[model samples]
Each structure stands twice: as C-alpha cells, then as structure tokens.
Target: MLWGKNIYRLSCISSGMSLFSNLMYISFIYSISAKNSDSDAQGLVHPIRDPRLLSGVRPGITSSQGTSLQGSYYLRNSYLRHNLKENQTGVPLFLTISVTDTNSCSPIENALVELWGANNHGLYSGFSKSGSPSSDCSSWLRGAMETDSEGLAKFETLYPGQEENRSLHLYAIIRTDWYEHSKNQTVDSDSSHNAAAIVQIFFPDSLNHQVLNRTDYKITGRQFVKNKQDFIFSSGQGVLKAKAELPKSSICGGVQAHVQISVDAHASQNITVTESPYQCKTNCKAYQNTTEQTTTISATSKHKPHFIPLAVIFFASTYVFYG
Candidate 1:
C-alpha cells in the first residue's frame, strides 16, 4: 500500500509540473507575438498641427514651375508631374504610400497624394531659400500622383537631405476632392474641408547616419537633425515615421520606405500652416570630405529560439524526482 501511494503521488506531481511548464512557455510566446503585432499593425491617425506644414508651398499652376511667392502652400493639382527623380543628386529613395480610411479601415482609391522635400543640399524645389529660383520656379523635388486600386502611391526620388532644425523628411498631402486653387490664395486659405490628411514622413536615425556619411551627402557639411530631437517628429509619436529597408547590395543602391496613413476621408481636420523653425538657409560649406565608403547592412533575420531545450530539461527533472 505504501509503495502504491508513492507512485500515485509522483504521477500527480509530474502532471502538475508539466502543466505549469506548458503554461509558462505559452505565455512567453504570446507576449512576443503581441509586441510584434503592435509594431507592424497600421491604422494610427496622424496629427494635424504639424509645424513643418508652415513651409508648405502651393503647387504652381504649371507642372514645370515650383510654388508661388505669395506664401508657402501645400501642392495640389500637379497630377501631371510624376517621377520626382529628375535632378537625382543624392541616394535614390523608393517611397510607397498606402492610404486607408480611418472610419472603415479600407483602402482609399484615387486619393491625390502629393510629395515634396529637399534635395541633396537640403533645398526645396520651389522655395528660393532652399536653393530654388527666387521666383520659386524650379519643381525638381516635388510631384503629385493618384493612389491606385490598392491605395498605393509610389515615388522614385532621392533621399531627402537634412535642414538646420528639421530631420530628413518628406511632406505629403492626401485629398479626396479636387479643389481649384485661386491665383492669389495661399496655403493658409480654408482648404481643410477637402484635405483628408497632411503629414510628414520620417526615416530611422541609424539609416540616416549611414546615408549622410556617403560622399554625395557628406559634401554638404550640414549637420543632420535626429528624429528624437525634431519636435515635429516627436509630436507625431511613431505614426508619421516610415519603415525603411536599406539596400543589401551595391547593385541595388537605393533604399525603400513603406508607410500606411489612416485618415477620415469624409471629415476635414483643420490643418493650419503656421511659421516653422526651419529656416531657408543654404547648405553649410563645411564638408567631412572623406572617400565614400560603402557599408552594407544585412536584413534582420527572424530566427525563433529553439524550445526543445526546455522540454529536455523538464523530462530530466521529472526522471530525477521519480527515480
């Protein structure tokens, strides 16, 4: 009777231990998956009080011309302009924008997506302070395109250079309706009714450091602003940032960024264009002036740790206790 009781007690203890170990392993897996889902999931709404919008230039009446001098305004109605890689001075950037409706979380088709940013020297195409014509006549780094059925708008352009107070960024505007711009109207005009969302796109600081170190960017001698230091970026949280995948080989020399923007298509959020800290200064003549070194970063591999060790340990402990 005593030996039989010992066997029964051992069986119960082993069952309990097995159950506890299984629960612990399941909890660990759940926590990791939840964290990853939060990072990869889309649908975060971008804030409207973007300080960078203050420099938003109105699209010129013609595709070839830049913004008007009346004041800076967001570009619209420049659909004819595509492929913003005309000047191609810096590292190539392949940008893809995915537009989704905040209400239904469905992809929005035919949304007008306008993108504008600075060149290798940190100069905007239209604004004179950024090295464009005084009349704001050059439109090299600005273009507009409509989202396709999948709500994707792709742009082939150079990686944006940094400004004094601003990190490397690209400005984007999504509109559902087409509104005609008055000849004298500025971006400050009440055009929010038609605008779905006005936001800025950002890159990772690690990638920025790598790209800026290249000869094309190093010649500018301008200090780059990190995303953490930029008020506009910090204010938007992580919603406005794009996920960049750097090129692994010299043959594929450009980087690709993907971002999904969620907006209320029917509702108009007030997007006021206020003055920004970004100045219209030319690039600093200072240059790091080093031989361009190519550094390749391999894509991060996702290898799950082997869980067999845990099972083996559990079995060994069971055997020791039972024996």
Candidate 2:
C-alpha cells in the first residue's frame, strides 16, 4: 500500500514492569582485552529530534524484502531464554532501565520499557532468514517488561555483537501509560498522550573491544570496529562505559553498567523514525539449517567496511498487514 509522490509500493514495521525491593542485578562481562584490531572512540550520541526521519533497523542484511521496525512480536520477561543452546553461549547481561520525567527528575513509575538487540554473533532472533518474507520469526534477544515502582526495568540477556562498521548497541521504546502498546498504538497529529521515544544504548568501544574478540563471539583473524566508525552517531554521544567488578569465575569477571532514560510524561504522539545506515559491501556465503537449507546475508567486506551517509527515510508507516 505504498502510494509515493508519483509511484506506489508497500512496507511495514514490546513491554512489562515489576516493582523493586530496590533490587540490584548483574552483568557478568569478562574483562579480557581484545586482540584483533583497533580504532579511536567517537563517543557521540544524539536524542531523536525529528520523529519522521524514521528508521527501524535490524541491519536490513537478510531483509532485502524489508522488516518492520516495530518488532513488538515477543514480550517476555527480563530473561529472554527462547533458544536454550544459543542462550548458553551468551553472557549474563543485566539491563536496567531507569525512567524519569525530564523536567521533574521524578521517577516515572510503571512505565513500559521494551528492549531488543543483536546477539553476540550479530544476528537477531526470529527474523534471520534470507528469503522473501522471512518466516520462522522465533527469537531470544527481543523482549519487554514493565518498570518497577522505582522506575527501573531489568533484563538478563547476552552481550550484543557487531555488524557493518558500527559499534554494538541496543534499541528501546519507552511509553507512558497511554503509549505502552507498540503493536496497535498510534499517535495523533493533536496527540492526547505522551509520545514514544525510540532509543539506542551504545556500549563503550573499550568494553565492546573486549567482548567482540571473545572466543564465544566467533569472528576472528581480523580487527574489531570502534565507536569512531558507527553510523548512528555524528560522534560518540551514546556510548555507555563499563565498570568491572570482582571476578566471579576463572574465565571472566562480573561487570556492570547502568543508564537513565527520560520519557516525556505528556502528549505529542511520535512515530518511530529511523536513519538507515549506508548499505554495506556484499560477500556471498552458504549455510544449512537443521531440517532445511538457508542463506545468511551480509554487507561486510574482508576488512571492516566504513559507513557512508544516505538520505534518511522520513516516512510514517507502522506495518501493513499481509492478508
């Protein structure tokens, strides 16, 4: 149902909470130094200023058929344990979301905070198929939960991997009481509810360095990319730095980091806009699924590819139903 300026086409595009005993969670990251390669950190992150500059991305790698940025398909607890074997390879990443009213600094209690990100190997769950209209959308890395009374929502998941030339990051949607439902909700021109905010939480390049090169992360023999090269940042404003704790095991130590997000408590409905990263170079490869054949697509080169600027797609389409 795409009716462009002169042509036509079609396209399309999570939550919960719990109260806290003031609970403190853990992110069991290993502090191993990465060996493959290096780059200077950008350390640049910006708030979503224009809502129509829409880009909902899952790397668009296997999705030449396109994907809905509004991936509210699964809303599980903080522990996103859908695939047991893949979950085992992941580290314990404790994600804490602290929600507050920007002007008041008061905690926004019971806010719905939904989060999703790529796994340690750079593939998202449920939608990794490379064929047209990808089926088998079961996954482990995407989930949603309600914030506790303290305005915090915590998740236990794996560290995300890198793709393209960008640094690793997580995507989230924060909603006030009226904006909680991502799948069926909409914001009006004269909004009566608070607008939703789509955000990306970037991990520090230093920590990303250590994590990406881990034996579990898979990609080897080459250098890892840093913040300086990520497409989302004009610089490195969104990189979250990591803090190390005492070692819990022989392989790695316990590490943690926390981030605070401000959601507008008032209204001005916003469509999640996106800024698609410049397309990457193509390299062909083949693989097999347990019961069938499948293809994995990538825009990467032998060496890490650099990002270029593309005219941002500022359209406002959630998702059109197929049937």
Candidate 3:
C-alpha cells in the first residue's frame, strides 16, 4: 500500500512535462568546445550579454509553441516504466540552426542553446519532477548544442501540437561565449557584440488543419502564401521556410500518427566578425553584476491576477489530503 501510494504521488506530480522545462535548464550549461589545431580553423565565439534585449519582432519564420490534446504513445504501461530507447515514433523530427556573427559572416561555433516545445498531441514532453517511465524526464526532447565553426547547431525531436490561445512555438534560450577555444572567457568589447535572433517557424494554416482535422483548425487570417503564415515567423525569409512536407512515420516500433509537416534550414546568411564574437556566460561574476537576476512570477498572476490565493487554497487541500 505504501509503495502504491508513493507511485501514485509520483505520477500525480508529473502527469505531463512540457517544453518550458528547457527554459529553466539554461543556466546549467558549462562551457567546453572540441579542440582543433589549425589557426584558420579555430575561431572565437562571444558570450551573449543580454539575450532578451537583442530581440525585435520575431520573424515570420523561426527555428521553434503553445498547446491542448493528449497524444497516443505507442508504448504500453509495461514498456513505459523500465525500457526506453527511441520514442516509438520513427525518428523524432530534427531541426538545425546555425548561429553566425553578423559582421564576420562566420559561425558562432560555441553558442549554447536550450530548446523546448509540446509533442504532436499538443502536450509538452517533459514538464516536472517525476521520473519519466519510458525515458528520463531529463532526456533528449530538449538539450544544449554548441555551434561548429561552420556556425551550425542541431536538435532532434518531434513537431509540437497546436493549443488554444497560444500559437505553435519553440522556445529557445541561448548563451554566448560558451564555445570551443573560449572556455571561461570574459566578454570583452571584442566578444560582447551581440547579434542573435529568436524567431518562430510556422506551418501553413491548411497544413496545420490537415495534420489534425480541417474542421478543428479553421484559417482565421486574410492572406495565404506558399510560405508565409504566422507573424512571429516573418523574418529570415529564405532560411526559415520548410523545404518539403514530411509524411507520417512510426514514433517507436509502434505506428505513429500521420506526420503532416517537416522542415530543414537551408538558407545562408552573411555573418560579420565583431570586436568580440561571444556573450559571457550569465553565471559568470562579471556578467552577473551587469545583468538583472531573474525571479519567477506565476503565469496566472499576470493573467487571472487572483490565481495566487486560489493556488494557496489548492495547496492547502493537497496538504490536508495527500500530505
């Protein structure tokens, strides 16, 4: 009975995990890059100082959602608990974005990136503290990638689901200066020149509906282009659009839901060399003194405003019954 109760509580705490978890893990990446002997080959990547400040309107095209529905996991309860290899879905979708110095037009090989989003069913894959049965809560859906001198970084996972109010999104947090040859480096003016973009990628409204059901996803906007859709994904026109639509495949060994879309980043942009090419790590003392420390505010506090008191009541109920 005690063991059963413990398991029940564990399940309750993490009924689902989402892309938001990736946002919190941004501070933990340590700087290290693979070494190469050639001087022409070896390059410097600057640490980003204030990532949020570099933002403008998100371009209509992006590298990354907000989501509603439950998805079908092919694995049964028996398979879910102990053995997890690849997700039963065939190959989870993979997307790569190359970080470049705007001036030098070179790869920002050491840029650190954190990414997260919902699964195809519109649920986030990893959201909380419970141990994942089919996989570790800290598994591969979200991860950190360092760019190569070629200025490229890649991630492999499934496409996200569309949720109400929130549009489809892929949230990413990037740290500059955490690259090869530049470990533990401070952000000098030479390295502090920040030029990075956090843009969203969107599917055509027709395709979005086709993936789920047309009746469910009605087109609300005025114009339709072969490529254009979401305002968040409007920039970097050449690199951001999907090359082709992907057909459905398996999630694991089991059959996966039909896949309606897939994309590859093929656009090339000019990168400029900077006085400094990388941003300093946020945890670094020099960086921290200059940067504002962050604190968590409840999402509802900004929205519903009265959510804190209701949350307290909910917590009290949990303490009385489950505690």
* Top of the candidates by TM-score: 1
Quickly count the clashes in candidate 1: 3
lDDT of 2 by residue, 144-196 (tens): 55566677877766667765455777776665532111111211111112225
Q: Which ten residues in a row have the lowest lDDT in candidate 3?
A: 74-83
**What lDDT, from 0 to 1, does candidate 1 have?**
0.57
Query: What's model 3's TM-score?
Result: 0.36
Looking at model 1, report the run of 10 residues with the lowest lDDT sum: 286-295
lDDT of 3: 0.35
Q: What is the lDDT for 245 in model 2?
A: 33
Best-first order by lDDT: 1, 2, 3
Can you write out model 1's per-residue Cα lDDT over 1-323, one digit (the tens) per residue? 99999998888777768865775676578657654643422111111222212222232122111111112433322322458878557888889999888888888776667788878776665454443323344457777766777879999988888766778888877666432222211121222233445677889999888877777666445677799888767766323789999877851398989999986666543343332223222331110111111012111222122233456556655665564
TM-score rank order: 1, 2, 3
Q: How do all models score by TM-score?
A: 0.55, 0.51, 0.36
- Model 3 alpha-carbon drift over 4 Å, by segment: 1-91, 125-140, 179-196, 213-323
lDDT of 3 by residue, 1-323 (tens): 99998998766554322222332232122111111112212223322233422222222222222110111221100110112223523224556655555555555555554444554544443332233332223232434555556555665655545543444545443335322223223222222222243234444455544444422323354122333444445443322343324445532222122111111122221122121112223232322212111111111111121212334445544554456
Cα error, residue 274 of model 1, in Å, equals 8.5
